[model samples]
Target chain A: MDYHWDWLFFFRETDDGLKYYDWILSGLGWTTLVSLASLALALALGSALGVMRTTPKRWLVAIGDAYVDVFRNIPLIVQLFMWFFVVPELVPDRLGMWMKQDLPYVVIAVVGLGLYTAARIAEQVKAGINSLSRGQRNAGLALGLTEWQTYRHVRLPMAYRIVLPAMTSEAMNIFKNSAVTYAVGILELYFQYKQIIEKTSQVLEITIVVTLAYFALAFLMNRLLAFIERRTRVPGLIVGGKGSN
Target chain B: MSDFDFSVILENWGFLAQGLRYTVQVTITAMLGGILIGTVLALMRLSSLPPLQWFAAGYVNIFRSVPLVQVILAFYLILPMVLQMITGKQMPIGAANSAYFTFTVFEAAYYSEIMRSGIQSVPRGQVAAGYAMGFTYGQTMRLVVLPQAFRNMLPVLLTQTIILFQDVSLVYAIGATDFFGAADKITQRDLRPVEMYTTVAVVYFVICFTLSRLVKLLQSRIAIIR
Candidate 1:
């Protein structure tokens, strides 16, 4: 019924000649890499989808809606499995072979996570754009600006600022969701924790450390976003304030 | 591409149905437990006591910061040890049972945030009005404020539940036989990864998509009432 706790197991070396801590550190690196790369993709694709969703064209809006609905409905793990196992087969033979044999798990994870998260971010961006006054769009048109120019200049900047808070949560979510990559055998932080625990049988200590690592990452992201929100606060433009009227 | 086999899914329909049943069961149990615990946490966060506020805040932040899969794995590994320590005997918490407990605790963090916002959306006058009617603090919350808050946040709560339903798949990390886990096992045994995964994806999509549309309709109806 008793257990021996080893707090120093992280300093020990594995059969692969790397210190246990080094493996964990590499896992952290992969997690960060996956999150950053996916975040970049999500933002670009999501912004485009969001704009499409809010457009006057019916077909474009339908396409955007379908994208969001499909991606958002399916769970991340299922999507990851689809990307890893099914997508390679669906492509051309040479490319499929490359994906199965040569493509890195990191790239697959990035594409899967990025596309899924883009659906969520697209919703946020759509809401942000919708929150702006209709007059803002009309005023841009009155200034003899083209529709594209009005969206580029008048709509997107304010919409981005307005959505910063929502985006903050999404960013944190992406980091947490990166752990799903572990299911596909990616050597991320969660995977490393599992590896260390399995090898050393020091489950509690490793769990605490891994939990702290995730907490620190999320806390840092929260603080960073809050700072940005403060810096970007518009004079008379407030978000979610009580009794602003 | 033209030679897709739909017969495999039909053959395994019973197994898949059982798995879906387990998935829905876990989702419902976790949703109920989460909302129950979340309401208490919400009240704790809103309470005037600093310790309560800190405890609630820490609980919410820790759960939100960590991934659910990690949490599930940790619980699956750690629960047995904790149980043994308490009872001075080995007590193995099976994967299915552990999934229920872990999902409830993990989801409470999210539900608490939603409940907190729901509580805040209530007008301050409602509380004063409750007091004006000669009600105590608990009476005020239990009777007036909570009912209205629940109504106001129903759509959001339902939307979060839809997410919780999807998240039940992650219990596969612990080898729990939820819907996704069942599919994974079949794929491994039958070597039909394409069909198994596609069917799983379509099932999840149909269920989630329908629920989301319902939530949207509810949201519009709520908006109109307001």
Candidate 2:
């Protein structure tokens, strides 16, 4: 067998190849959009669930626990497919048809990815909130702040700062998982890569390019998250010291 | 909806069973393959040589960053092309059927990081002790370090197994008739999405739930041993 290396295939002006590359970029755009939307939703839902899990009320804690358990245990693709296929059918007929036909796929993608990631983020937030001293809560109560006020003004901000690093990893995980949306035909980066490979038969070139794109995005995200984490570092906390306080 | 029929699921139980078997097979194969490959990568990353460490690190970073679906797609589409290019012949059906090969290689990149962390978590003092006792570095790693590291890694391994089991479904995109693929075919034919998907979901839940409990038991046992 003979081996020939063709680096120029990636750079050459080929119609099918260029179109495939364009499709991949479009897919990357959708991936980024879905990931950002899901990140927003996860933050909102996760914070509420996290706060509720720490609530003194029995029913709220139970509700929060059940929500986390259901989402955390299920496979993400199952959840995505369920939402995409089963969910629309369960709705009232008019609404169902609208969702199945007119409603945007991106919305469903965001909901699926967001809700799943929220379960994890909730746990991280709960840990972050719990890591603080009981004295802080008592101090807020002692100062005559209402429960909601205290949390809004003091506890949440602190918890958010503490959980930033964990949240960063969770966000990255969610972004990567969002690629599964391509299965439902969302035309995300991976989906585009598949289309490209099928057309040009330049499987290796497309894979290498797409892989590099993913790495660049993830690396940038990590740096951004690290920056946020550093900015929020509690004064006097040992920055890089290991062995857990 | 009353249209949701239990009878359909009951009638299709045999097909579902077949799918479940295939899913389990893929899961087991992928888990074992991934763990073996991941362990080697982990050791490579931990090696004294810079190039090996760099290569392994790059592998992990690239695979981990890309979505698993992309990795699977790459394996399905690219592996065949590359194979044909090198061998001057079409790849074997057996290699194609065993999509677990791709799943395992992809998963290994992630597993290596998991294993590396577990290995690193072992106290340096243990290695020093092993060295003092005249054990070579390889001997110390094999006899002293890895056992302790594996013990520490039980829970993570279990979690990874659960993820791997779920990932087996992605192979369906490439035409492997795993549990999800079977369910998809059934749903397409029977037009009973609710019944078929619910059955599929429950089957997955039970397997994952059982494995999770097993993980907890193993963790407790490891705790006792430590």
Candidate 3:
């Protein structure tokens, strides 16, 4: 068979005649949903771990360090699998049964990607906090503030601001990384891209369209985050938005 | 842990060994190839010429934004078709080759960013000093700037290397029998997804965690105060 271009392949249904383009729109919907949900999880968990790492308690620091190490070094795809296949089996009887039967790929993707990305965010958050003057921590303690209060009242707000630019990159990365959720049978954009190609056999055109779509999403996401970062940036910290890849 | 058995992994050492070999081979080759392409892109990005800068930036942006799996799939699925049309011949690229090419090209975007930041980390006065000493731009960059820059960013580069190693597992998606792929085959065969996945995760953690600690030590050793 000879190669042929089919620009209108997305409009074509599967042999069963399911609406094709709607599949793509739904996939895009899931991708956005998974990314935003995962971002929320990551920011909350990561900031906690970051604060823990800098605390005076030795065990807390170790636990935070171990969490970062365990999550950061593992492949995200593997984590997705663990959450999907293994995690369900480990839960108690009724819940495990329900999970195996009804758990959504988007939920698993959110948890998996959130935990994995949280490690990197923790490091960024820690860096942002460490860059602050030690005097701030001292001031908080001198004011009779507990460690939690110090972190909440004095450290985390400023740290989040300092880390905003780097965090923007992480936010953009999560959206791109959400593509891997397709591995666990999530019908996200990549899965739909592969599905359309498998059905129509127009590999080149479909792949180009998908690639450009991803580029557009990433570009827009970057612009939005950069604007927020610019607004939240401190008066004279030299950490300009030199983006990482 | 109760259901886990070491004998399964022990009996499958040969399979894992083969997978490990491919992993090392792919990682090293891609690291070298990525560094080469990335250095060029970084230089182009930092160049005085506007077109060169824009071209480099655009290339990095596109590649970085696309997920690695999509890029890998595109190469595996799309490139051969384009090659056939251009050459009028059916040239089949195998999974391993496609994985290699994809990782190299995809990773160059990340490495380019690292290299650009590394190069920028060098003090500007060094280049000026090189010029004052009658050195050409190339001589200044090669002799004075890069040495210090590499030292300054060695930890960051090594950190990225760890990240690259973690990402190599994505090769499994294309059925390249790397470390994760081998585990996956056994996992499917034995229906021991948890055990196999745990083993794979532990192996990755050990290798990457140790290397990161070494990088941290090296970072402290070679830190540039300025």
Candidate 4:
């Protein structure tokens, strides 16, 4: 063996019989919480902005474009640092103190991750909406529905279905992105992994475990979304447009 | 708020440029390495041989599913130790080299997928016709398919490059002074995290936004209008 491998490192007790595995599980909890919270925020804001981007009005589309452009371009770490250090300072004194001192780092991670992923999600949603035939939108309006109602009743459902494949990938992307929350001091999986490495010199063992954990997370998300995508896929919509005939 | 000064940007331009150079260096080097490796991987996945196909599939799945930071970290911290053990000597790889190598391998997975699709986008007829003209499979792909596939995937390749640039920021995890790392150092030094960090964000936004615009323009211009 080129290296000594400790197969039971996760089972090793740190204090009072509490194994290192406990810390990892708790970190997983935080990672899941931040990712789920960010997913919710990204979806809500992304759909709104996505709808705005596809609307007939120029300014609303412009607002949507600007939001995606600004947020998507900035690195998530830089954005998190801004949310952590800059946003608090720009706010009121008490709020600043609260964010600086009291507000949990996980919450800040959620905000940063959510807003950042929202930009990418918005683009996916817009593409989905554009993929739908114009007749769908026209039909809804022709049936005496208002534009919002047409979008809500006709466009969004189909758009969501159309983009579900892309959206699934984005969901996995955000889960992976949540790993960066370590920079903000959230003791997520990566943070726990780092702490473990600091205490134990079993670098390869710990990295393999953590990397597998993330791979499993992403794989499950991809599979689940793919399942949903298959179940919800409209028949005959797969042929797509402008075939090079 | 008024006391927040942007003067630090100019003062630290030299320092920041050094970091920026590393960022650009890694990106360009990794992109070229990735494209070459990824083209091979793409061919593997598309091959009739079961082992090559399976190996390529497994490679893509493993790399794509894991976060890039962890990959970077593994190469940075673990690879050197492994190297030392294998060589029976202390071999301390620089953080920049580790990052560059990791990114090259990591980005290849992504590039493989893009190239796979780009290859698929080229009609079967082209490959068939090449073979019909007495070309070997490699010759067909090299002569007929790849040139068209490259044109087809140009936009996606550039988009991935833009993404590669953003991800270079993560090199800071291993203490490599990429662009974000340099700014981080200034923020720590000047005790002005907000100003320094915001300025860094602005630079990223402007550069990325402008490049994305260029990407869009080029995408439209080269769109294979059938």
Query: All candidates' TM-scores?
Result: 0.97, 0.92, 0.93, 0.95
For A1-245, candidate 4 gives per-residue lDDT tens digits of: 26779979889997647798998888888888888899999999999999999999999999999999999899898899999999998888898999999988878889999999999899988998998889999999999999999988899888898777678789988878998889889988888888888888788899888888887777777787777776776787762232111
Cα lDDT tens digits, model 1, A1-245, are 57788889889889999999998889989998999899999999999999999989999999999999999999999999999998887888899999999998889999999999999999999998999999999999999998788789999989988888788889988889999999998899999988888899999899899889888887787788888877777778776343111
lDDT of 4 by residue, B1-226 (tens): 6667768788888988899899999999999999999999999999999999999999998999877877888788887877887888888889988988899999999999999999999999999899999999889999999999989899999999999999999987788999899989988898887777888899899999999999999999999545
Enumerate the chain B TM-scores of all models. Answer: 0.98, 0.93, 0.94, 0.96
Chain A accuracy as TM-score for every candidate:
0.95, 0.91, 0.89, 0.92
iRMS (Å) per candidate: 1.1, 1.9, 2.1, 1.4
lDDT of each residue in A99-124, candidate 2, tens digit only: 88998988988999999989999998
Model 2 interface root-mean-square deviation: 1.9
Q: Output DockQ, candidate 2.
A: 0.56
| DockQ score of each predicted structure, in the order shown | 0.80, 0.56, 0.60, 0.71
> Local error of candidate 1 at A238, Å?
3.4
- Model 4, residue A162: what's the lDDT? 70
TM-score, candidate 3, is 0.93
Write model 3 residue lDDT over A4-79, tens digit each, in one string.
7777767776676666677777878888888889999999999889988998899999999999999988889888
Error of 1 at A159 (Å): 0.3
Steric clash pairs (candidate 2) = A27-A189
List runs of model 4 lying over 4 Å from the truth: A15-17, A230-245
True contacts kept of 4: 0.74
The TM-score between candidate 1 and the true structure equals 0.97
Q: Candidate 2 or 3, higher TM-score? A: 3
Per-residue lDDT tens digits for candidate 3, residues B86-120, read 89899899998888888888888988998898899
Candidate that scores best on DockQ: 1
